[model samples]
Target: MSGRQEQINLDTLEPQQLAQVKKQLDEELEHLTNSFAQLHAAQNKFKDCLRCVKSRSGAPEDIGTGFLVEKKLKSAEKFYESKVEELGNNLKDLEVIVQRKQTNARTIEEVLRQKILASQGQDQQQA
Candidate 1:
Protein backbone atom coordinates (compact mmCIF):
# COMPACT_ATOMS: atom_id res chain seq x y z
CA MET A 1 0.00 0.00 0.00
CA SER A 2 3.11 2.24 -0.24
CA GLY A 3 2.39 5.56 -2.07
CA ARG A 4 -1.17 4.37 -2.78
CA GLN A 5 -4.43 5.80 -1.45
CA GLU A 6 -5.85 3.10 0.80
CA GLN A 7 -8.44 4.04 3.42
CA ILE A 8 -9.03 1.46 6.13
CA ASN A 9 -12.03 2.21 8.33
CA LEU A 10 -11.47 0.95 11.87
CA ASP A 11 -15.22 0.38 12.32
CA THR A 12 -15.22 -2.09 9.39
CA LEU A 13 -11.82 -3.68 10.11
CA GLU A 14 -11.56 -7.44 10.84
CA PRO A 15 -10.65 -8.54 14.36
CA GLN A 16 -7.25 -9.82 13.24
CA GLN A 17 -6.42 -6.62 11.36
CA LEU A 18 -7.40 -4.48 14.32
CA ALA A 19 -5.18 -6.58 16.63
CA GLN A 20 -2.23 -6.19 14.24
CA VAL A 21 -2.73 -2.43 14.11
CA LYS A 22 -2.92 -2.26 17.90
CA LYS A 23 0.31 -4.27 18.24
CA GLN A 24 2.13 -1.97 15.80
CA LEU A 25 0.90 1.10 17.66
CA ASP A 26 2.07 -0.36 21.00
CA GLU A 27 5.56 -1.03 19.60
CA GLU A 28 5.82 2.47 18.18
CA LEU A 29 4.72 4.01 21.48
CA GLU A 30 7.35 1.99 23.36
CA HIS A 31 10.09 3.11 20.93
CA LEU A 32 9.06 6.77 21.26
CA THR A 33 8.96 6.60 25.07
CA ASN A 34 12.46 5.05 25.15
CA SER A 35 13.82 7.72 22.82
CA PHE A 36 12.35 10.49 25.02
CA ALA A 37 14.00 8.98 28.11
CA GLN A 38 17.41 8.87 26.39
CA LEU A 39 17.05 12.49 25.29
CA HIS A 40 16.05 13.58 28.80
CA ALA A 41 19.11 11.82 30.27
CA ALA A 42 21.41 13.54 27.75
CA GLN A 43 19.91 16.94 28.60
CA ASN A 44 20.48 16.35 32.33
CA LYS A 45 24.10 15.39 31.65
CA PHE A 46 24.62 18.56 29.59
CA LYS A 47 23.20 20.70 32.45
CA ASP A 48 25.51 18.97 34.90
CA CYS A 49 28.52 19.73 32.67
CA LEU A 50 27.51 23.38 32.57
CA ARG A 51 27.31 23.51 36.38
CA CYS A 52 30.71 21.82 36.65
CA VAL A 53 32.31 24.32 34.25
CA LYS A 54 30.87 27.27 36.18
CA SER A 55 32.15 25.84 39.48
CA ARG A 56 35.68 25.30 38.10
CA SER A 57 36.00 28.88 36.80
CA GLY A 58 37.58 29.97 40.18
CA ALA A 59 36.63 32.70 42.70
CA PRO A 60 36.79 36.43 41.81
CA GLU A 61 39.27 37.10 44.67
CA ASP A 62 41.79 34.58 43.31
CA ILE A 63 42.70 36.82 40.34
CA GLY A 64 42.74 40.65 39.99
CA THR A 65 41.03 40.74 36.54
CA GLY A 66 38.61 38.01 37.60
CA PHE A 67 36.74 40.41 39.93
CA LEU A 68 36.08 42.94 37.20
CA VAL A 69 35.17 40.21 34.72
CA GLU A 70 32.83 38.51 37.18
CA LYS A 71 31.13 41.82 38.07
CA LYS A 72 30.52 42.61 34.36
CA LEU A 73 29.28 39.07 33.70
CA LYS A 74 26.84 39.32 36.63
CA SER A 75 25.56 42.70 35.38
CA ALA A 76 25.00 41.28 31.90
CA GLU A 77 23.22 38.23 33.36
CA LYS A 78 20.89 40.49 35.38
CA PHE A 79 20.09 42.58 32.29
CA TYR A 80 19.24 39.48 30.28
CA GLU A 81 17.15 38.08 33.14
CA SER A 82 15.09 41.29 33.37
CA LYS A 83 14.56 41.30 29.61
CA VAL A 84 13.38 37.69 29.69
CA GLU A 85 10.95 38.52 32.54
CA GLU A 86 9.54 41.52 30.64
CA LEU A 87 9.07 39.42 27.50
CA GLY A 88 7.35 36.72 29.54
CA ASN A 89 4.90 39.26 30.95
CA ASN A 90 4.18 40.56 27.45
CA LEU A 91 3.56 37.00 26.23
CA LYS A 92 1.10 36.42 29.08
CA ASP A 93 -0.77 39.63 28.19
CA LEU A 94 -0.97 38.49 24.56
CA GLU A 95 -2.33 35.10 25.65
CA VAL A 96 -5.10 36.81 27.66
CA ILE A 97 -6.01 39.00 24.66
CA VAL A 98 -6.11 35.95 22.34
CA GLN A 99 -8.34 34.05 24.76
CA ARG A 100 -10.75 37.01 25.03
CA LYS A 101 -10.92 37.34 21.24
CA GLN A 102 -11.60 33.62 20.82
CA THR A 103 -14.42 33.76 23.37
CA ASN A 104 -15.96 36.76 21.56
CA ALA A 105 -15.74 34.93 18.21
CA ARG A 106 -17.45 31.84 19.58
CA THR A 107 -20.21 33.98 21.11
CA ILE A 108 -20.75 35.77 17.80
CA GLU A 109 -20.88 32.47 15.90
CA GLU A 110 -23.47 31.06 18.28
CA VAL A 111 -25.64 34.17 17.96
CA LEU A 112 -25.46 34.01 14.16
CA ARG A 113 -26.36 30.31 14.16
CA GLN A 114 -29.41 30.97 16.38
CA LYS A 115 -30.59 33.83 14.13
CA ILE A 116 -30.25 31.65 11.02
CA LEU A 117 -32.21 28.81 12.64
CA ALA A 118 -34.94 31.22 13.79
CA SER A 119 -35.20 32.76 10.30
CA GLN A 120 -35.44 29.28 8.73
CA GLY A 121 -38.22 28.34 11.19
CA GLN A 122 -40.18 31.55 10.31
CA ASP A 123 -39.79 30.81 6.58
CA GLN A 124 -41.10 27.31 7.08
CA GLN A 125 -44.12 28.65 9.02
CA GLN A 126 -44.90 31.16 6.22
CA ALA A 127 -44.69 28.45 3.54
Candidate 2:
Protein backbone atom coordinates (compact mmCIF):
# COMPACT_ATOMS: atom_id res chain seq x y z
CA MET A 1 0.00 0.00 0.00
CA SER A 2 1.17 3.52 -0.70
CA GLY A 3 2.03 5.63 2.29
CA ARG A 4 -0.46 8.28 1.29
CA GLN A 5 -3.70 9.58 2.66
CA GLU A 6 -6.35 11.52 0.83
CA GLN A 7 -7.99 14.54 2.39
CA ILE A 8 -11.52 13.83 3.64
CA ASN A 9 -14.52 16.11 2.97
CA LEU A 10 -15.71 16.03 6.55
CA ASP A 11 -16.28 19.79 6.49
CA THR A 12 -18.98 19.61 3.87
CA LEU A 13 -20.75 16.61 5.31
CA GLU A 14 -24.12 17.04 6.97
CA PRO A 15 -24.23 16.19 10.67
CA GLN A 16 -26.07 12.98 9.85
CA GLN A 17 -23.49 12.00 7.25
CA LEU A 18 -20.63 12.50 9.69
CA ALA A 19 -22.45 10.60 12.40
CA GLN A 20 -23.20 7.63 10.12
CA VAL A 21 -19.59 7.45 8.94
CA LYS A 22 -18.31 7.50 12.51
CA LYS A 23 -20.74 4.79 13.54
CA GLN A 24 -19.66 2.55 10.67
CA LEU A 25 -15.94 3.05 11.34
CA ASP A 26 -16.45 2.31 15.02
CA GLU A 27 -18.29 -0.94 14.24
CA GLU A 28 -15.70 -2.05 11.70
CA LEU A 29 -12.83 -1.37 14.08
CA GLU A 30 -14.56 -3.29 16.85
CA HIS A 31 -15.11 -6.34 14.63
CA LEU A 32 -11.54 -6.24 13.27
CA THR A 33 -10.02 -6.02 16.75
CA ASN A 34 -12.30 -8.73 18.13
CA SER A 35 -11.51 -11.16 15.29
CA PHE A 36 -7.78 -10.61 15.71
CA ALA A 37 -8.03 -11.28 19.43
CA GLN A 38 -10.09 -14.41 18.84
CA LEU A 39 -7.53 -15.72 16.35
CA HIS A 40 -4.70 -15.56 18.88
CA ALA A 41 -6.91 -16.85 21.64
CA ALA A 42 -7.95 -19.85 19.53
CA GLN A 43 -4.32 -20.70 18.85
CA ASN A 44 -3.65 -20.78 22.56
CA LYS A 45 -6.81 -22.77 23.13
CA PHE A 46 -5.72 -25.39 20.59
CA LYS A 47 -2.44 -25.75 22.42
CA ASP A 48 -4.34 -26.27 25.64
CA CYS A 49 -6.70 -28.70 23.91
CA LEU A 50 -3.75 -30.95 23.11
CA ARG A 51 -3.98 -31.96 26.73
CA CYS A 52 -6.92 -34.17 25.70
CA VAL A 53 -4.62 -36.38 23.66
CA LYS A 54 -1.49 -35.88 25.72
CA SER A 55 -2.97 -37.54 28.80
CA ARG A 56 -3.07 -40.84 26.97
CA SER A 57 0.24 -40.50 25.15
CA GLY A 58 2.53 -40.28 28.18
CA ALA A 59 3.87 -43.07 30.38
CA PRO A 60 1.12 -45.34 31.54
CA GLU A 61 -0.23 -44.73 34.97
CA ASP A 62 -1.68 -47.47 37.21
CA ILE A 63 -4.96 -48.85 35.97
CA GLY A 64 -6.89 -47.21 38.82
CA THR A 65 -5.06 -43.89 38.35
CA GLY A 66 -5.47 -44.06 34.57
CA PHE A 67 -9.26 -43.99 34.80
CA LEU A 68 -9.28 -40.89 36.99
CA VAL A 69 -6.85 -38.97 34.79
CA GLU A 70 -8.78 -39.92 31.68
CA LYS A 71 -11.97 -38.75 33.29
CA LYS A 72 -10.41 -35.48 34.37
CA LEU A 73 -8.89 -34.92 30.95
CA LYS A 74 -12.19 -35.59 29.26
CA SER A 75 -13.92 -33.14 31.58
CA ALA A 76 -11.30 -30.54 30.85
CA GLU A 77 -11.79 -31.03 27.11
CA LYS A 78 -15.52 -30.59 27.51
CA PHE A 79 -15.00 -27.42 29.53
CA TYR A 80 -12.68 -25.99 26.91
CA GLU A 81 -15.03 -26.79 24.08
CA SER A 82 -17.99 -25.33 25.90
CA LYS A 83 -16.05 -22.13 26.55
CA VAL A 84 -15.22 -21.80 22.84
CA GLU A 85 -18.83 -22.40 21.91
CA GLU A 86 -19.91 -19.77 24.41
CA LEU A 87 -17.57 -17.28 22.79
CA GLY A 88 -18.98 -18.14 19.38
CA ASN A 89 -22.48 -17.56 20.67
CA ASN A 90 -21.43 -14.26 22.17
CA LEU A 91 -20.11 -13.18 18.79
CA LYS A 92 -23.40 -14.09 17.22
CA ASP A 93 -25.21 -12.01 19.81
CA LEU A 94 -22.99 -9.08 19.04
CA GLU A 95 -23.86 -9.48 15.36
CA VAL A 96 -27.52 -9.38 16.26
CA ILE A 97 -27.02 -6.21 18.29
CA VAL A 98 -25.21 -4.48 15.42
CA GLN A 99 -27.95 -5.50 13.03
CA ARG A 100 -30.58 -4.10 15.36
CA LYS A 101 -28.70 -0.83 15.63
CA GLN A 102 -28.51 -0.54 11.84
CA THR A 103 -32.23 -1.11 11.56
CA ASN A 104 -32.99 1.43 14.27
CA ALA A 105 -30.73 4.00 12.66
CA ARG A 106 -32.47 3.68 9.33
CA THR A 107 -35.83 4.00 11.03
CA ILE A 108 -34.70 7.13 12.85
CA GLU A 109 -33.41 8.61 9.60
CA GLU A 110 -36.75 8.11 7.93
CA VAL A 111 -38.63 9.62 10.86
CA LEU A 112 -36.33 12.63 10.94
CA ARG A 113 -36.84 13.26 7.24
CA GLN A 114 -40.60 13.09 7.68
CA LYS A 115 -40.49 15.48 10.59
CA ILE A 116 -38.33 17.92 8.66
CA LEU A 117 -40.70 17.88 5.72
CA ALA A 118 -43.70 18.33 7.99
CA SER A 119 -42.10 21.33 9.65
CA GLN A 120 -41.25 22.81 6.28
CA GLY A 121 -44.84 22.41 5.13
CA GLN A 122 -46.14 24.12 8.27
CA ASP A 123 -43.69 27.01 7.72
CA GLN A 124 -44.87 27.46 4.12
CA GLN A 125 -48.53 27.36 5.15
CA GLN A 126 -47.93 30.09 7.73
CA ALA A 127 -46.08 32.32 5.24
Output the number of the lDDT-best candidate: 2
**lDDT tens readout by residue for model 1, 8-118:** 555455445555655654565455455545545554554555454445544455355535555655665565555545545554554554454455445444554565676
TM-score of 2: 0.43
Model 2: per-residue Cα lDDT at residue 45: 77
Model 1: per-residue Cα lDDT at residue 57: 48
In the predicted model 2, the residue pairs found to clash are none
> Over 4 Å off in model 1, which ranges?
1-67
Total backbone collisions for each predicted model: 0, 0
Per-residue lDDT tens digits of candidate 2, residues 70-91? Answer: 5666677777777767766666
Error of 2 at 82 (Å): 0.6
lDDT on C-alpha atoms for all candidate structures: 0.53, 0.61
